[model samples]
Structures are given as C-alpha cells and as structure tokens.
Target: MNTADFIKARAAALGFDVCRFASASEPWSAGERLAHFVEAGRHGDMGWMETTLERRAHPTSMWAEAKTAVVLGLNYGPGHDPLPEMGDASAGYISVYARGDDYHEVIKGRLKTLAGQIAARTGEDVKVFVDTAPLMEKPLAQRAGVGWQGKHTNLLSRTRGNWLFLGVILTAAELEPDAPESEHCGACTACLDVCPTQAFPAPFQLDARRCLSYLTIEFAGPWPVEFRKATGSRIYGCDDCLAICPWNKFAVASHESRVQAREGLVSPRLADLAALDDAAFRALFSKSPVKRIGRDRFVRNVLYAIGNSGDADLIEAARALLDDPAPVVRGGAVWALSRLMDDEAFAALRSERAGGEADASVRVEWAADQA
Candidate 1:
C-alpha cells in the first residue's frame, strides 16, 4: 500500500472511525462564512475567534512547511438516548461530550502517537491539533471527506452521526486529498426547530451570544436575561438540536472508554450539585472537562437550573446559597429563589441584598426580583 493507504489503516488501528486528507491551504469559503459570523457579533464573548482569523482560515499560514492536513474522527455516541433524563426537572443536564475524560488530552495524545509513527516511517515534520489550535476543524473535516457541515454548523457523518470529536494533523509530506462531502441537510429543519434558544438565526449559521452552550460555559458574567428561560436546566452545554437530528439513528456507542459518561454526571441531582463547595466540586470533577468553568460558574449554572426546576423542595438549597462569596453565584441564587419560592422568601432575600456588597450586575438582579 502507498503512504495514504498506510496512514488510513494506521488511523483505524488507533481507534479512529474515519480518516481523510486535504491539501494544506486557505479554506476561502469557510473563512468567508466565519468572517460573516464574527462580523455580526455572533461569536459573543468568544473574542479569540475574531482575533485569530488568518490562522483559523489557512493551515499553511499557521505552519509554512505544512503540505497535507489530515482530519480524523472518533465516535463517542452514547448507547442510550440522552434526551429522556433532560425532561426530569430535578435532574441537571450535562452535555454528553463533557461527562467523561477531557477529549482534548485523549485525542491529542493519540494524534501525537500517529504523528510519531508517520515521522518514523517518512522522517517528516508534523504538528497535531485537537481543538486547542485556531484551525477550523469542522471545515477541514468536511474537506477531508469525514462529513459535511450540518445546518447547526457542527461536523456530521452519516455513519457516526453528530457524535464525533475531530482531530487534525498537519505534515510537510504530500498526501492524496479526498473530495469534500456533499451537504445532506436538504429541506429538513429538525435541528433549527428543536433549539430551545433559537440559537441559529438561519441555516448553517449560529449566534453564539444566544447559544445556551456559550451562555452557560463561555460567557462569564450574569446569565443574559433574555435567554435564561429558554436555557431550561442545561447547566453546561445545549444538545437539543443535535439530539433531534434524524441522522443519529445510525450512531453506535463509542469504543473509547474515556468518552463514557461518569456515574454522577449523566443526570446529577440539582440540589446535590447546588450544595457543592469549591473543594468538593474540584474533587468530584478533577479530571472532567466541566471543572474548567470553576466552582463559582458551575454553581451559578446549577442555581439557574434549580430556579427552573419548580420543585419547592429545592428552594431551601437556593436560599442557603444566597450568601455565596462569588457575586455571580449569589445573584443566581437570588434569581432561583425569586422564581421557585413564595413572595415571603423573595422579600426576605431582597431585604438582605441591601446589606450585601455585591457587583452592580448582581445588585440589578436583586432589584429586578423585588420589582
């Protein structure tokens, strides 16, 4: 077999579901779409996306010696449906991707191993990226024939569904490039219709400012008022659109153990998560990706979900968190109390807001509850 075939076989052996190569060059069309998305302020507080335009659009610009860009996909689809537990109000929902080990470390290690194997065989310089670099991975994956970019703007494969994590390897060695996959969305709007926040303004476009994933994980302030009600109990990331996709029927459980859901993360109790102190939270999520958001932000997200739970039993948990040191957490607690408790409880919390020195945003949240 030639070099391309050899690489493909090696990738499969290394547990990659699919592998494809693309010429290292500017992704002009994808860049144009990204530029439009950024210019519209659709990326929200993710300002890094705007600053790294050149590096994000062109692989050759990132590394001068790069000649072939190999894109690989690893399937992490769950065996059971993830939507049922989401309907349970007392249960806090975490995005499936984050329930286990961090994919960045897992995928990057495998990519490096693959790169080392290539170096030994061909003596070529290489770099591997697993979402850490500014590379437009979804576009590269599509160009490499792994999948088409779905209407929701995530990479989607017919065989693996939307449950694949992407990794890229850039090398100086020339490899035969694969043809890009054709778009399969057709006239179907299942993803758009199912979005709780209406994050997608149009087909193949996303406004991350309104995206629950961005609001819960990326945005680092008080949750935006407009999207809060739509956020439901999603504490980390939103998967409504992805879950509703018709293409998911073909998906199977991933063989990678690192991608499996943890015991507590699959559908955690809201009250239990709301009570987690910093150390306890750290101990529970030490190696998980959700820990990156930190205890304060994670607690704030839990408070929002508790507010939506409508379970009067959880109100005591929300009340106990009113004195949290982080104003963000305190503000979320106040909001939860306002939503889930009686007027007497809200009035009591409102009285304490005067003595508490909180951020201007949290103060506004307090006043809004009183009003």
Candidate 2:
C-alpha cells in the first residue's frame, strides 16, 4: 500500500470510522462563506473566526509546506434517542457530545500518536488539530469525502449522520486525494424546521447569534432574552436540529468508551444543577467541556432553563439564587423567579435584592422583570 492507504488503515486501526485525504492546495469557497458570515454579523461573539480567516480559508496560506490534508471522523452517535429527555422541561438538556469525556481530550492524544507514526514513516513536518485551530474541519472533511455540511451547518453523512467528531492532520507528504462527497439533502427541511430560534437564514447559512449552541455554549454573559424561552431547557449545548436530521437512521452508536454518556450529565435535573456552587460544579465537571463555562455561566444557563421549566417545585431553587454574588447568575435567577413566582412574591424579592445589586446589567434584568 502507498503512504495514503497506509494512513487510512492506521486511522481505522486507531478507531477512526472514516479517513480521507484532500490536496492541501484544493480550491474551496469556505473563505468567501466565512468572510460573508463574519461581515453579516452572523458570527456573533466569535471574533476568533475573523482573525483566523487567513489560514482557515486556504490550507496553503496557513503553511506553504502543507501538501496533504487528512480529515478523520470519529463516530459519537448517541446510543438512544435524545429527543424525549430534551422534551422534559424540568430536566436540563446537555448536548450528547458533551455528556461524555471532552472530545478534545479523547481525540488529541490519538491524533498526536498518528502524527508521530506518519512522521516516523515519512520524514515530514506535521500538525494535528482537534477543533482548536482555525482550520475549517467541516469544509476540509467535505473536500476529503468524509462528509458533507448538512442544512444545520454541521458535518454529516448517511454513514456517520450528525454525530461525529472531526480531527485534522496536515502533513508535508503528498498523498493522493479522495473524491469529494456530493450533497444528499435533496429537498429535506427537517433540520431547518426543527430550529427553535430559526437560526438558518437560508439553505446553508446559519446565524450563530440565534443558534442555541452559540447562546448556551459560546456566547458570554447573559443570553439575548428573546432567545431564552426558545432555548427550552438546553443548559449546555443543543442538538435539536441535528437530532431532526433524516440521515441519522443509518448511524451506529459510538464504540469509543470515553464518548459514552456519563451518569448524570445526559439530562440533569434543573433544580439540582441550579443549586451547584462553584466547588461542586468544578468537582462534577472536572475534565468535561462543560467546566470551561465556569460555575457562574453554567448556573446562569440553568436558571434560564428553570424559569422555562414551568415546574413550580423548582421555585425555591430559583429564589435561593436571588442573592448570588455573580451578577449573571443573579440576573438569570431574577428572570426565573419572575417566570415561576406570582407578582406579589416576585415584587418583594426584587425590592429586597435591587438595592444591593452592583452590576448595571443585572439591575436592568431586575427592572425588566417588573414590566
């Protein structure tokens, strides 16, 4: 077998479900799409996308030595349907990928190992990236025949569907490139129809500001208010549009042990998550990606979910957080209590809390609740 074939075999041996190569100089339109996306303000708070455009748009621009691009996919298809639990308002819906070990952690070492193997076989410089770098993995994956970007703007195929993690290996070796995959979406609008916030502006365009994944995971501080109720109980990342994809029927459950859902993270109780202090939050999420959001941010999301829960039993949890030191968390608490409590009780709590609150943002949240 040649170098490319050897690498594909090695990737399969290393647990990758699909491995394909694309020429580093392969022409693509991701640059134009990205520029337009950023210029249109669709990227929201993700300013990094703008800064990384030079390298992300074109592979050769990032590194002139980059000759072969290897895009690998690891299946993380959920064992069971996630829609039912997502439907339960009292339960917080953590996206399926995040319920397990962090993909960056799980996939990084493997990529490095594979990179080392490639280096040993062929004397060439290499860089392995697992979603950290600016390199556009989905576009590269599409160019490499691994998958196509679905209507949700996530990499998906009939084989891996929407539940796959991508890792890219840029090498100096000149490997034969594979034929790219064509779009299979046909006239399907399942993903488009399922978005609670209508994030997609058109067939392939996505407005990240209105995306649940962006609001719950990427966007900092409090949510945009208008999208909070539309977010439902999604405390972490979201999977609504992805779950609605028709190609998912062919997906196989992830075989990797580390990708399996952790005990309580799949769909946690809103009240329990709402009560987590910083220490408890850190201890629970340790190596998980959810830890990156920090206790305050995570709790803020929980409060939004609790308010939307319509579960009167969770009122005490929301009320207990009215005095939270983190203004963002307290702001979310104000919103939740306003939704769960009657006007008289909510008014009294708001009156007591408003005098001492320092953050103008939180104060605005408190005042808004009165209206």
Best by TM-score: 2
Residue-level lDDT of model 1, residues 232-309, one tens digit each, is: 789999888888888998899999999899899988999999999999999988788899999999999999988888
Instruction: Compute the lDDT of residue 370 as modeled in candidate 1.
Output: 29
Model 1 residue 117 lDDT score: 84
Q: Which ten residues in a row have the lowest lDDT in candidate 2?
A: 362-371
Predicted structure 1: lDDT: 0.86
State the local distance difference test value for candidate 2.
Answer: 0.88
Against the true structure, what is each candidate's TM-score? 0.97, 0.97
Global fold similarity of model 2 (TM-score): 0.97
Write the residue-wise lDDT of candidate 2 on 223-296 in tens digits. 87778888889888889888888888888899998988989997789989988999999999988999998999
- How accurate locally is residue 95 in candidate 1, as Cα lDDT from 0 to 100? 96
